[model samples]
Target: MSQGIEAADDLAPEIRQFHEAINSGYAAHPPQPGQTMADRRQVAERVRAPWAAGGPAMARTDELRVGPRGVRIRIHRPVLDRGLPSLLYIHGGGWMLFSLDTHDRLMREYAARAGIAVIGVDYSLSPEAKFPTALEEIVSVIDWLRQDGAGAGLDPSRIAIAGDSAGANMAVAANLLLRRQAKPLLDGMLLNYGAFDHAVTPSHQRYGGDGYMLNSAEMVVFWDAYLRGPADYEDPLAVPLRADLQGLPPAFLAIAGCDILADGNLSMAAALRAAGVPVVANLYEGASHSFLEAVSISPLADRALTESATWLARRLGRTCG
Candidate 1:
C-alpha cells in the first residue's frame, strides 16, 4: 500500500467547507448567457486571487523566452541557495486556463519550503493553442534548462519537474520525449491529482461528480478543448499513462483520495514501479483536486506539498527543510 496520508474514514472538514463555499458561490453567481471561455477564465482567476496572494521572497526572478512558440517562463530562486536545484513547474487548469500569475504563490512556496529553484512556464492555453503545443513548449523549457541552467542560476543535474492536473501530464510527457531522444532530462517528478488517460476508471465512478472542482463532465469539456482530435487522445505524449514507463526518473505522485483522477495517479505509480522506477506515492484523504491552491488555508494541502517536495529533494540531494 502507498504511504503518507491514507484515505480517511470521512472527508477533512476544511476540504468539505471549501467545497460548500465554492458550490454556494457558484450557485449565487451563475454563469451569464453566452459566457465565453475568456469570461470563465477571468472569473476563475478572480475567485482564486485570494488564495494565490503573497508568498516567500525570492532571491532572484527573471522572465525569459525559450523559443519560437513565444513560451515565456519565470524563474524563481530561493534566497538561501544561489545555485539551487530547480524544477520546471507547470500550472493546472484543465490545459485551458491558469498561468504563471495564477500559480505564482504556489511555486514560491515550493522554492522556499523545499529549498529549490522553480521555473514557472507560461505556455499557451487551448481552444487557441490546443494539445501538443503546450506539451512542445514544456519540452522546450526542459531543453533550455538542460543547456543553460548554470548560466540561468540553477543546478542542471538536480533539476526535476512538477505540476498539478494537466500541468503534471505535461511534465510526464516532456520527460518521455526527452528520454526518447536519449537525453533523460529530469531528476524527479511531482504529479498531483493528474488526468492521465481520457478513459474512465473506478475512482471516476466513485468521485467523478457533483462539486469536486473537477467533475467527470467538466473533464470531458476540458479534453475536447485541449485536444485537436480523437487521435490526440491516443498519443502517448498526450495521454502519458498510455506511454511506456521504463527509464523514467523517480517520481512522487500526490493523489487526492476523493478526486476523480486518484485512480490515474495510482495506476501511474504502479506502472512506474513495474518498470523499476523508484516511486513514492501519497494519497491525501478527502483532498480535492487542485486543493494545493489552498496552501495557506488547508493543512492537508500544505503537508502534501511539503512531503512531495521532501521526497524529490531527497532524491536530488536538495534541502526539503
Candidate 2:
C-alpha cells in the first residue's frame, strides 16, 4: 500500500513505446567487450541529448571552481520573482556514467516544479578517478555552496542534497561527513533508487540476471571500477548503509520494486527510522531502476516523479502550481 500507486493498465502508450525503444537499443548494443564504461556513458548521453536540448530554457548556466576540480554546475531557477530553497543535485550512473547533461531534463523539471533553485554537479567519473574522488568533489561543492551559493541566487541555509543510485550514496555520505566534521548542515535528502549497500541483498540474488535491467554483474563491474580496493567497500563513504544513521537529516527515499537494489533501500529506511531519523520510503510496484528518467513517456515514471517532487516540495516548504 504505497502512497502513490499507478496501475500498469493505466500507463500511456507513449510511455510503453519509449520503454520499447530503450529496450530495443539495449538489446542491439548489449554490454560487450571493448565497450568501456565511457562508451556506455556516451551512449546514454546521446540517447538523452535530444530531450535535454529541447527541455525548458534555463535562466543561465554557471561554473563553480572548488579546489583543482573546476566543477561544472548548472543553476535552474523558477520563473517566479521570489527566492526559494536550493537543492544540490547529483546525477546517477552507478558512479561510472552520466553527467549533468544526461540528467538535464529531470533536474530542470525538479527546479521548476519544486519552485526551488537546482544546482547540478558535474563530478568526475570513475575508472579514471576512483572512490573518494567523487566523495571529495561533492564535499567541496557543498562547501562552496554554503559559502557562495547565496550569491548565485540560492538560499544556502535551506540547501538539501539529492541524487539517484551512486549519486544518492554520495549525497548521504557527504551529509554524514559534514555532520562528523561539524560543517554546514543540510536541510534534508532526496534519495531515488539509491545504492546504499554493495553487498548482495536478497533482491540482488533474485534479479542478478538481465531482463530486469541493471544486472548484478554490471553492478559489480561498476563497483570494481569505483573502489580503490576491497577495504573501501567497508568504509561508510563507500557504503552509507553501514554508517551510523543517528542525527542525520530527514530523507525521502523512492525505490523501485523490481530493482535489485530494492531491499537495500528498504533496509536503509528501516535503519534510519530505528535511529530516530525521519524517513519517507515509497516502493513503486512494477517499476525498474532508472524509471525516473523515463517519466516523460511512462505513466508510472510520471507518477514517481510527481510523488518525489511533491515530497521534496513539502520538505522544502514550497507549493507547486
Candidate 3:
C-alpha cells in the first residue's frame, strides 16, 4: 500500500464517526412502505423534509416548469459582485432519496469558493417517478438554465453540469442527450462517485458485505427501486457506463478509494478518455461514498471540495481569490 492510502487508512476513527452520524440520521425516520405510486411520492416528499431544514438557505429559491413536472431549484449566487459561470447541480440519494435541500451546504461552499452561480435541481425521485422521469427533469432544467440563467446574472454559455452518485449518472446522461440533439453545450462536467453500471464489478463483489459502507445489497435495493424494470438497466441513461462516451464535454471525476462504486467510476473515466474526451480523475484515499457531504466538518472533505472547485474554476476560465 502507498503512503497516501496508508495515511487515509489511519483515519478510521473519523470515518466511523461520520458513518454513525449518517446512519443515525437516516434511522430516525426510515422510508415508509408504499402501496401505490402516490403513496411513494408522499413518502419521498416527507423524506426530503429534513434535508430542506439541514442546510443554509440559498439567495433565491423557486419552482419552475421543466416539461410537465414542476421542478424546484435553488440558486446560490457568487459572494462577489460579478458575472460568474453557472453550474446545474444534481444531488445524490441513490436516485430514491435526497434533493436540493440535502446538498445545500456543499453547493453554497462551491458558489462561495468558485465564484460561480450554483443551481441545485430537485429532480424527481425513483420508483414513483422512475428512470426516464429524473433524466427528463434534469435535461429540462439544463434547457431552462440555457434560456433563463443568463438573466439571473449568469453566463449561460459558461455553464457546467455536475452531480454526485446517482445525480452524476443523471448529469452524464443529460450531457449525452444534449450532444445527441446537437443543442446547447456544457463547459464541463463534474461526476462524483457515481454509479454507472448495474453489472457488478470487482469492487462490488469485493465489498458486497458491510464495513465498507454502501454494500451491494443496499445498492441492489436502491437500483430495484429506481429502475422501472430489468430492461431499463441496459439503457444508457440509466447505466451511463454502458453508453458510448465519445464527443462529450471535458470531465472531472472523483472516486472514493474504498467505495464499491470505485471501480465503476475508474472504468467510466478510462472509457471517456479512450473515446477522446479530456478527463481528470481523482481517487481520494480512504474516502467512502458521499464524503463530499461531510465537507462542513471533515478536513479531508474540505480538501477534496477545494480541489474539485479549483478544477471546476480552471475549466470555466474563472480565477478565485
Top model by lDDT, which number?
Answer: 1
Q: Write the per-residue lDDT of candidate 3 for residues 106-222, one digit (tens) a residue.
A: 787777667778888887777777888888888887777777766666676788989998889988999878877788668889999998887788988765555565778768878
lDDT of each: 0.81, 0.78, 0.75
Ranking of predictions according to lDDT? 1, 2, 3
Candidate 1, which ten residues in sequence have the lowest lDDT sum? 1-10
lDDT per residue as tens, model 1, 1-321? 011122223557777665655555455456899999898777777666666788678878889987656679998877745567888899998988877988999998888878888899998899898988888888887777777777877777678889999988988998888877778658888888888888888888777755566778778888999999989989899899999988888899999888889889999999989999998899998787877877777899889988987887787687675
Clash list (residue pairs), candidate 3? none
lDDT of 2: 0.78
lDDT of 1 at 6: 26
User: Against the true structure, candidate 3 has what lDDT?
Assistant: 0.75
lDDT of 2 by residue, 1-321 (tens): 001112233224444354455556545556678887677877777765654554456665555565356677877776544456888899988788878987888888787777788889888888899989988888888888777766766676788889998889998999888877888668889999888988888889765564555678878888898999989999997899999989889999999887789999999999999999999999987777777777666678777777878888888888963
Q: What is the lDDT of residue 261 in candidate 2?
A: 95
Which segments of model 2 are wrong by more than 4 Å? 1-19, 27-37, 50-68, 80-82
Q: Residue 104 deviation, candidate 1, in Å?
A: 1.5
Candidate 1 residues lying further than 4 Å off, grouped into runs, are: 1-9, 24-29
